[model samples]
Target chain A: MVFSKEVKSVRTQTWIGIMSVASLVAIAGIFLKVAMSTQPREENYENITKPGYAIRRKYFWALLIVSVVCLVISVISFPYPAIMEAKITGEPVVVKATGFQFGWELDKDVLPVGKPVRFDVTAKDVNHGFGIYYHGKDGSLKKGIFVAQTQAMPDYINKLYVTFKDPGVYRIWCLEYCGAAHHIMTYEFRVE
Target chain B: MDVADRSMYERRVSGIALGYGAITLVLFGVTVFFGVIMRTSQGEFISVRPDVLYEFMTLHSIGAGGSLMAGVMAVMWYTLRKHLDMSMNIMQVVFGIIGAAVVTIVAVTLLGYYGTGWTFLYPLPFKSAGAWYDFAPGMWLLALMCVIFAFAMSWIDVIRAASKKYGFSNAMGWTLISGTAKPENVPPPVVLISTVTAACGLLSLVAGFIVVSLMLIHWANPSYYLDYLFIKNLIYYFGHIVMNMIMYMCAAIVYELMPIYANRPWKSNKIVAISWNSAFVAVTLAYWHHLLQDFPQPLIFQFLGVFGSYMAAFPATVVTITGTLILIYKSGMKWKVAPLYMYLGLMGWAIGGFWAVMDAGFNQAVHNTMYVPSHFHTYLLVGAAFIFVGGLYHITEELGGCRDTFEDKLGLWTWFVGGYGFVLWFMISGVLGTPRRYAVQMPGTEIYSTAAVYFAWTVVFGLLIAIARYLTRLQSVKPLRG
Candidate 1:
């Protein structure tokens, strides 16, 4: 019965405590190794190509060290309960939406037949999955991910880079489940 | 083993079933385990190679699903047999077993080509596994046949139990049944609701069979006109109902057992009827929520699906919470292992329900992510499995007359704590942006370190809990004499 006055045996309690302590030590050791391996600036190597990534990297490491020290003092079961942002850098590019259609003017849509035009895609309110529909030789919408993953941005700007290597009209559509009228949210551009 | 008694015979049969289920679950678990490792490694220091991660990711989703289908179907077979008044038809049961065996054999033999997730979306199955992955039609056909046999057996049992207890006309004639029922009392509501859910399951199975056949036909010949979208719609229709069937089985167990703990036998007949009717209405309409993700489902369908989702969660929530309250205050309680199992089982179901509803509500940002898996895993593994285990234990005790020893008590505690803890931990990892199918978390992400720790802990806890329970159950007793 649940109310029975049975208590944990002292030996078992001690054993449990011992195991917990050992696990705690292992956890701490790993945390330290991760911290020491990546110097602050080096962590932002992925965003190196983006604007101001180098400078942001420096500050990011400093914040991390400070956070880790705070973590040690607070010493809860988990390490860093809040998400520690790995410093990223990019400027938002706004595009106009007309009714159920979205459009971007990149100064002359015509290019060589085999040339690739990469479009920076983002959404305004909720998450948007951008799928580019380029027609193949057979004329069906050749499906591919302009941005396969739903890139989350609070202010509705996501930079999606896609290359169009074939000449034809390619339609851009948001794949993420936005709100009502998502299906009609489409745009088209032609490659020469 | 020693000279085999009936219990031993039962044990051997159950053991083989358990072993098959366990290996399947473990394989599924291991695939997920490796996935966790890979997903964490990416943005974190732990990043494993992408190629390695991809291999596991591809296997993990599809593989785990295959195992789940096998395990749940197998467990249902055992439970369905026990619940029936008369023994089930041997031929049907054998057919179910062999059908499952063939599915498993085909699945394992062609593991190399089994990616494309369990949905086996048309072109993906063909594109990925080519002819070998094309074995899905066979898998689905077996599933449909298995469902028919399972349902027929279940229907026979329920109809017989209901007719024997309450005359068929009276059982349907009563508008409602009120107050709680005793443990053994087969309430018209419980019988009716379970039957309806089983019916829905049969419909879903048939739908799935039809869709999978078309998909196979499409695969056999790459036709430009093949509507993959329609096939997907049908698959989701069936796919969505199967989980509800599992939930209904657990609910049936809850309805049956809660009174035993509360000592409040059936009183009002009307309330029972209403509850059954409400469940029948809610469960049938609830298949729409599964289509809410990524798919281009209509807004009308989405709204209806969400409504059904909330409706489905509401009734069980009331029953379970009300039952728990009655057990707590109304009855001068005995806190034995069996009751503990039931109480904890209720808690698991309730917790699962809480997360399920929370995750369903679109307002909650957390619901959209991998955290959803955390919710479902809590429901399926703890909510469903815990109740199933408790029901099994009840039979092992009351029917088999097996008493709990100190070690058995330890086994119970280990299961309760280890399971709940592991799930909580797994959820934390999920919340940390550990992608569900990936072998590792995206590297250099903030959640990587914490997710890894939690994952590793879950694996440890799961192994310990599972092994301890396995050993405890291994301790046997004299069989039930006729």
Candidate 2:
């Protein structure tokens, strides 16, 4: 099972890497072609402006439609509404998390698997990041992938909701740069 | 303005700009070196203490931002002088303040060990966890106050001068948009952009001044309490707007220079006018995107963040990028270093914008990750830096009669390859979920940092060659003749 999950992760990374590279290359190539082109001395301004405006109109509309669609889709996937709803309904286990310069103090060290956990995260002294990382059985963070996170600002509570499907150990690391020892600002917990 | 007066004005402004550009380029080189040091520390190639690494990170941010802001301000001032009689005395004052701030920032970060990130989020600077001296944060804030005051002074002068030359409304292209003015009577594209940039920049500077003053007050009086979320919002607002203004200032330069190279008029029509006016609003609201991860932020503002981020791209894509491509398409323009850098710079801006919009929308996945820096470095390092360098080369060749050589061309290509390669690693690491600003990397993430170090060195080597070329030309430059 571990091997299979690793394979899946690698596949996803490779796919994203290839897609990003391809998009950048395609964009760069188009710009390079235009850059290398020599303008004709006899070109007419009218000929260029007319078609250019026409194409620009189409491009503008296309961008608008695509961006709006993405916005709606992303908004739907946002974790805020669920977290807010969980807070109002009191359906999830509430874990109070307070971050300091080099540590996180959680009210609860254990949570239930297959149930929602609401982390009411805030900072005691300064701003820190409440980043949850998956932990391996050997007591180390797993490959640095953040499971979820929210800012832990002093005097403010940022609610982050997460559900652990499988029973395992997990770790919390400060994602924001708070101090010199920020890297060591980690806390461990169990979800059973 | 008479012909002789205009020529004299050009010479004076260009000389100041050339000097400022040289200083900025040198600062940029130092910042790049600092960046390499941070990366190498993360890669475990050098064993620096974590506190030392944070110090370098702080300096890197301050130096790069200061250099870019000061450099682009000079570029805008030089370009705007063609149309408006901006005060050279004010420009000198701005330069002096920035120079002093740079020195203070270096001392505070390196000597006093002020490791609070450049954002200098409230309470963090005061509660330094014993990593830095108590006086460091105060000194840092004081220096920042000076920088903001300088920028504020510059913007006030730009607005006052522009309003005098062309009515404020006309300068902002509002008259063109409202059809109160004829198309031929419209301000040039640079004027329109500079006015909008100045207005937004001045507003952001006010926010910066307020926030820094509040922090300074808190530093002095520990009993005085402030709202953390409100302060965070203000910080990001000021930081985000100032950063965006750097790009907009470069856009102003492009609008002015691209036309001369293409031998075409890139005028401010109704559409161009409307685009920039909307940009002014979009850029202001887009700061909300930086606060997206702060869940306590209002939901309405979060939604606006996404919307504003999307809208911010409209002006650049619809007007500036497309217009430049179309202008040069069949104009039989030469592929000089200036045009080449400007062309690639625009391309970088577009590419970086795509990634930025993605990150802004999907903050849950990438907020504070290396992805944040990935997108910014793409835009700032490759996008704004290229534009500024191109502007400098353009002015140097035009006013000082400096010519590009084979070595200059080779150096540019090297910089291009190394820069893209360096940022590519950052992008990949971001995708892999590596968090940014970590002195010690996670177990599996150090590999990317190790690989990035080579690319960083390549970039430094390329930049050194470019600087050498620039200096060689500078020594041979003759005075401008009418």
Candidate 3:
């Protein structure tokens, strides 16, 4: 299967940047306006205080409402096991992943495309991160283009769920700093 | 106290503040140099051994954190001394402890090659894979303990003095909450903020002590096992709170000095009181955001992480940022270096804070990536660091009669432009899914790292110019009498 590389998450990240830039530009404008208007004038504290308080009241409410809305949206889309289970149609494939000092070991190397897969990741020593990177038609893992990740720590298994839409190689890189040669801690698998 | 006694006291405090400021400046310079090296190495501009790169990473974390903490604490101590009867002896001892700890940290990282990064995590230190000497981790932990101890001592004195003067409730602006505040009874914004930060700092230090002690015990005996998740929680709690307190300390400085520039009084109101009081609780809870990637962690706590993170922005945005804009609007405030840096600092705080809250909401996309460092660098370097630099300039001008020259303004603008440029690339890299703490950049990510190197150098050049100007002014110092 040939899949478009522009995934939903990438679009979401682009929106994050756009929104942040828009907000930042507006804020900078306000500061600049205030900064340039340096006319020598004195105003009564009492007069400013009353209106300031009223504005603050409204501002606080606006912030509260926006925050609550964001919180609701984020929680609904959170990548927990229960939420992941609800999104899939059939029983999910289970893969066990164990991370050691500079490498990863996955019990299942080939996963079915268009099917949900659960990665039960654990670490033998120290803590590592189980991060998956998608390699499209090229079949080579590109640096800095991760799709999903979760922590891999000793004595604990962290479950990460994903459905590969493309039949190609996916690479696993350690996201957490796990001592020497952490950058070389990479593993690869395929979906068919 | 008689006039002579008061004059002597003021001078003594001034001297100590300057001493701390000078030490902090040195730390900032060295740590920033280390940072430039790390970034350049990642960009492949220079070759550094992997072990050496990690060592620099460890030192940069501790050093940058220490510099900011010291700078803001100096500002707070200086500002609070006028209102409260804090002991100078305790501050002197803190200065000594910090100096010694810096030496120990450098020795351990350089000679012992202790490259476990700053958090040391849990077992990473013990499982160094023959990368470092056996004694390095224990020594590094002890050194950090000393630094925490020094900070704890300072907080104790601040709390003790404030409590003695205004009572604990009044110090925290609780009296304002009940509408029973008398003119003389209400603490200034600085005092209120400092008290809250100190209380929280003390609690975090206690957590630090517990976690460090546990690590030490485990290090001493291989038979004694530890829970990885539990230790991780405690570490983030302690580390995150300490960093937040340092930012709050910068706010305390701004609360005191921004008013002076605007020629208006920022008195403690009921709203101000409510915002900070809530912040005390919210800051601690917000540490959960750091653990959002730990899947086995409880789901409720993850929600709390998002909630706490958003709530943490409320006080800053609704109160401090808004109040600052109102105060300066048409107030004919002078755009001197002090207020200029401060104003930009507040802007950085607001911008950086917006991204921070966004990151909290969308943790899965950006966590542990360059985006993490990008957001923090925005607030820490451009926000908190700018505020401290502004405060230092204000203090020196007032006491030592240091005047802002043309070079000062030039340096300030250079720093402002370069600082933003440096962080912008980090943010972009993060968006591209580049993981942080990598000694060598993954092939494609090296492009962003390479771009960041030039910007980082610009910041260093700006800083050097500013430091030169500041040192020249120090020669003509004459302490002002009360």
Candidate 4:
């Protein structure tokens, strides 16, 4: 409910931005104060005031309450991760994708569009990141944009949730570093 | 022990601290050089073989993280031992294990060609697919296990020594929180180090045990299975905790030492104690934040991660930064080279913590592609590294009975300017959304990456200056006798 503003999603960036500004301000203030403060040969500020125990106690409680509030707000509105939240309603086309150190092997090279394709990603030789990307006009992985992906670890199957709505060629590139050829680990599949 | 014997023993330990800290500094230098090489390669300013780049990648990652750990531990232990009695035998054991671990790790990466990257991620280590030798992964894992065990042992010793001095309850500053004892009764160093040692010890056990056990099983049977998500959490947490602990450990040094320069007593107060206690929880739960983008991670944990990540920032200011600020407030600060680093180190910690909190969000995870590495580098390089280097400057100056020299200023400014410049480029690239860990980057990323390389050279110059100063200072000390 707290993130129920115009964006519909929690604007975490705004909060971070505010915090960043505050941080810069605090740092600058401290640095200036330190730079400007009188430098003496010996310590001179005798019997600097210390707060009463009561004020300290109040601060302790205030911090505790603030922490509790933050925790509560986050807890109450916590949504399932994206994949979990948008579980496919109908049966999906199953695809078995195997990741090797340098390449990928899918059940089929071309995937049929319109049906949700559920990829059971597994690594044959080593762990590789199975990031599905679509290349831009430059035709370089450098220009490749991410679509959907999951880590392909050996001896483990990661069921990646995806449903391609449009016809296009996509590439499965290893995201996690496996070895020398990790960057070269890629497989292209056509969605028609 | 007689005063003469005690002083001799203290001198011996001081020599060991200087020796170990120097080794770590060397290791840091090597890794930073390789890091520049990789950045330049990725930026396409120069061309290198793919395998070679990756080999350097793997080495640089682990080398930086691991060496920093060993380096800071020695600095902290040296300071700690001066205050209370510690087992010299235990120190020797730690030194031996670290020596063995670093040798094995460097050998496997450079000589044996283990290039799976430091996370070793999981299944990747088991299935190198002929890129690396079969046994190399196992050896790397064993090396990591050795380092983990050694560090854990060191922490255990610190905890035991501290608890004994303060009675275990007061050691953690819990009595301050409970209001059973006055805050002044317990030293702030004990509270900070005790909390970090205990938390890191327990969490490291969880991570180390799970990972090494799973890894051993794979080595033994090759048919045995482990869950992907489980292994991911374990390895990530292990790495995260270690990185997080570096901040805590070095901050411990700052809290204890900085006030000495500023002429203020950093007493363990309600806010300070509470902030740190909160940090203990925050650092642990913050691990889940790293896994937020993973589809399989639980929803509540993701929320907890958000909360935890934010919680960590509290101590950064309320305890460490503000505490320093208040300590230095209008008090005549000496502004020595060592204390200057400490002050900047606090600035680094605050700035880096802010960047980290920004990147921790699930929505912002996309933006974190490059920002993650930048945030961490900012914290580690400028933040924790500064505090620690400052501490070293303090220790060397104090023990060597030397005065601050013009040479010290040269070392100080160069390191500061060059280090900050390099990190600035990284953050700039992050803001521009240049993805990290990519062997190669897009055209748009080249400028920032190229700039980083130039600044890196500046850092090297600074390091050379620092090394020269330290060497001159250390030259006065007599060699330790057997």
Candidate 5:
């Protein structure tokens, strides 16, 4: 299946970049403004004698609140795990995954497209990351990053809920460096 | 003889601080080689196994972070001691503990192949999936526990000293909270370090508990388990605090040294006091932002974490930055490398900090992306690293009677250029969706590593010149006893 790769929000990214660059330019501008300034040094501007500090303090606090509010809003909008709040319209394909020394084992392989899949992951021997990757339009076998993941604990199961709208060959890789052949830890699946 | 009235306590503390700084510098030098090697391997210029690369990752992160903290802490202990009566006994003991911890850390990474990254999150340390000896994680945990104990002890000493001079509330800049005392009376550094000490002290205790808990589980019931979320939070809380404290304490160095370099007094004011106090309040919840991707962690925490982080982080950087810019505005001080590094450090801190805030902000979804490693590396290397180095150089030149001249401007420029270049690699790579801590590199990822490898070598060369100068000059001169 072909789709534009991970329609990463250009607007969001651009906004973040603008904020980052704007802050830099502002700080740098102020730094340059101050560093290059040949203004005569004022005397007795130590704490009590400093003027406009009240105004500075007021502005500082106001900016602090504004930035924090902005940050919280950004966090809310950013992509978060829909697992907890997800209302399943239909039953999610439940795949039981067990991880061990060198590999991953899944109970089933085929997953339907436009469906939610719940990966119930656990470890038989140790800790592992149940990281699932989708086949990009470029069709690369994902080794490093993954689409959805959760901890595969030895005694407890970690449930990860993910919905794939596009059908593609996907792979699961252990993200946590487990052992010597950890690089070889991979499992492939299908979305039909 | 020096004209200053010398106290034995002062001399002893200074000696230990120098000792710590020396060890830190040496550790950083070794770790940089590992970093360079890892980058080269990632660039596909060399062939190495995934395990080896992972091992180096663990070694390099802990080694460099530990080294920088030690260097800056030495400066903190040295400078703070002069102003406030810090504990000599605590300093001495920690100095010894740090030595032991360093040896053990090196052994665990080199000899035992403890490849669980510095975070050592959850059960990864307990169960290495057949890569390392069972003892490797145990040894690493114990060493880390020891390091935590030493750090906690030192922090306790700071708390005690601050509390002794100023009451706990005032030491924490409670006047800012209550609007009782004037900001000028609340000394910024004391308030700053005390706040940091409290946060780190709590984190260390939590770390100690988890380490001991994990050890007990290891020995008694090998099959025993933990709430992965709980352990993950604890470990990151410890790691985050450790990383930030390296900056917080180093900021003390900047707070003390920057003024001296500029020949001005950076007095405590309403802004400084309020900012530092706010940090004390907000820092407690900030580490949770690190776990926004962990799914199992609640959304409420993610929100709280992001808010707490920005609140804690923004104020101090803003106040210090504005303060520094204003200090240098009209002060006609010569821009020596020491002071230049200070300016550069502050600039890096501000820029890097912006990246960090963005990474924390959920709207970006940059956490766990390439953005994480790049932003952190920016802060750690360009921001915290420069602050600690500049502060150390300042302390040494003034008090330790060391003069460094005819140094490699070539090396310095190369370092600055390469450092920024390497930082850009991380930022760009992160933006382009290159994952961090990947043992084996994907094809496109090699491009970032290739650029980083060349840039890293320049950084190493610059450091080599700087370190050579420091060691030669410092070796002949004992901190203050001479």
Candidate 6:
């Protein structure tokens, strides 16, 4: 047998190799152009005004260099995209006071009328629309954050600005729809 | 008709249809079970929680989407080969199945990334780790290749077959050209709709390939997200149009196939065809409506999209109302479960089509939240599901099988009632403001809890009915073969 096992047809092989190389080069050029075009401005998460808008660090050029280097090193080598997370803070929180069949429960179970403390409210199961029902305090109802669902991530944490005006027991319940015991999934918290 | 020739062709087509239907049945079962898990696990976490959630979601989407797609293909092929006298290459048909299978696998893999349903948004593909779940871009590309190849081959065969029988200017062409018209006066509306839908599928393949390729590029280089929402734009058009194509394909099956049972051939061919083609072209521009729901796409495109959205329903309504009324009123007919199922399917399609069209109203967009999908799912699941069932029923004899027993009838009815009840309950919950895919809803803020009780009971009853019917059918398979 020939040392090269009858080397493949030169013209056909050369054409395919050239074509592939040209295609790859074209693709690389386009990629580099995109990567070098403009570094993505770091999303300014500290801009408390916009809750979910994240400004990530400009790493597009770095990523581009790595991708190009990989392509040159091994065309068959798969490229794993980098994970970019924008930390969101100062998001609004909503605490539901009522609409629960049985009513709302506090972690401490009760609070004095004048007590000042911060409470983070979350749905035990399913999403419950909750927020203090008051006039002009921007009585916006907070929808539960569906963890893992990107759509619900923003709505997950809502900040509540409220002060108990009177002494009473407030009730909260799961609002959206959990299951068979959903109606019974309620609790009461008292302020005095 | 030559008995051998008819039997040979019939047997082959039926064989393929049966195989497709059987696989579809299994997929449906998988989807329902996984759907229960996905639904039940909301707000609650089990060990392997995210992974399980991912698994359930992946299988659920693929099972629902892929099974329906296969059902559409099987029925469309059966209708064309038998009713329309359109002969396709056997190899091409097999290739189409292979493509679907490959796509199913790719779809499942993508689900691991839990890409958040079929319209996997671009930037997210690399943003989240749970989303990737060890899935590579190669799988997606391979699957894409399979589907494109399959559709390309099928497209070739359809052109060859239809062209051989009728020229480019044939009535079939008129349906695509002018929209829906009278059969006697124009071309067969069903054929026209099917052809146009297939054409859309071809176009979608192009877009899908481009989008998938872009996704691969993004995977290779994270910086590609800065590339100006290029992939995002392609996906909206590709995903929406492909979905419409699937729906149109199911509609095509019923429009053509239901007539045989009713003893009425399709009429108003040119009008119907023209309506579908118009719908097809209009929908190509309409996908931007989804964009208006979120993200930054041009407002003008959204305006055009809203208008285009309505165009799809015009054909849907014209075909459904006119066809069903003719079948029921003009033609004196006895009520059988199969034909009843077809009518029910028509109702579902019409209702869903109406809701989808209605939801496009600018003011009405807010209320579309969960209800829109509920309304649309009625068409996707019940409408399309019933047609698939009807096709299966029709092909029973040809599949070397038949559902002759009273139990089988009961089982078929069970499928009908169960499917309808499930979808109706699901849709009603949406209307009541129960968000879709919530692991759990809070106790009292919404009425969905009450609806959930009803929904759960309905599902249980429906599941029992389905199991009984499936068992009965399994037992009777032997007798039907003889």
Write model 4 residue lDDT over B301-349, tens digit each, in one string. 7787888887887776566666666567567777788888777877888
Tens digits of lDDT, candidate 6, B348-408: 6766665554444331112223555556666776676666766666566334354455655
DockQ of each: 0.02, 0.60, 0.71, 0.29, 0.37, 0.01
lDDT of 2: 0.84
User: Can you tell me which runs of candidate 3 are displaced by over 4 Å?
Assistant: A1-6, B1-8, B480-482
Q: Tens digits of per-residue lDDT for model 1 on B1-482?
A: 45557556665445534444454445545554644554456436565554444444445544444444444444444444444443334423644554474455345334643433444444444443132345644454444445445444544455555556654433432333433434344443445545555555667767766776676566566674455445556766767666666666566555666556545453325534554556556665656654444323454565565556566654564443443443344244455565556556556655665555434433112323344555665566555655555555554555445566665566556555555555555455443323333333323223534544554445445544544554355344233221
Candidate 6 residue B423 Cα shift, in angstroms, is 3.8
TM score of chain A per candidate: 0.36, 0.81, 0.88, 0.58, 0.67, 0.31
Ranking by lDDT: 3, 2, 4, 5, 6, 1
Docking outcome class, model 2: medium
Off by over 4 Å in 2: A1-22, A39-42, A81-90, A137-142, B1-11, B480-482
At residue B436, what lDDT does model 5 achieve? 58
Instruction: Give the Å shift of residue B352 in candidate 5.
Output: 2.2
Residues B105-196 of candidate 3: C-alpha lDDT, one tens digit per residue: 99999999899888889999899889999899888898889998999999999999998998999998899998988878889999999999
Instruction: Return the interface RMSD of the candidates, in order shown, one decimal each.
Output: 23.5, 2.5, 1.5, 4.6, 4.0, 27.9
lDDT of 2 at B155: 90
Sequence-dependent TM-score of model 6? 0.65
lDDT of 2 by residue, B1-482 (tens): 89778777766676678878888988988987898899888988998899999999999988897898899889888888888888998999999999999999999999999998788988889898789999999999999999999999999988998888788999898898888986555788898899999999999999999999999999899899999889988999999999989999999999999999888888888888898889989988889998887887888899899889999889988888888888887788888998788788888898888788877877776778787887888888888988888888887887777778998888788888888988899989987768889999876789999998888888888888877777676665454333
* Greater-TM-score candidate between 1 and 2: 2
Residue runs of model 5 more than 4 Å from their true location after superposition:
A1-6, A9-33, A38-69, A72-75, A78-101, A115-127, A130-132, A137-165, B1-13, B182-185, B188-192, B195-203, B216-221, B400-411, B475-481
What is the TM-score, restricted to chain A, for candidate 4? 0.58
Query: How do the candidates score on chain B by TM-score?
Result: 0.75, 0.97, 0.97, 0.95, 0.92, 0.83
TM-score of each: 0.60, 0.95, 0.97, 0.85, 0.88, 0.65
lDDT of each: 0.46, 0.84, 0.86, 0.70, 0.69, 0.49
Order the candidates by TM-score, highest first — what do you get? Answer: 3, 2, 5, 4, 6, 1
Which candidate comes out best when scored by DockQ? 3
Candidate 6 chain B: 10-residue stretch with minimal lDDT: B360-369
Q: After superposition, how far is residue B41 of candidate 1 from its true place, in Å?
A: 7.6
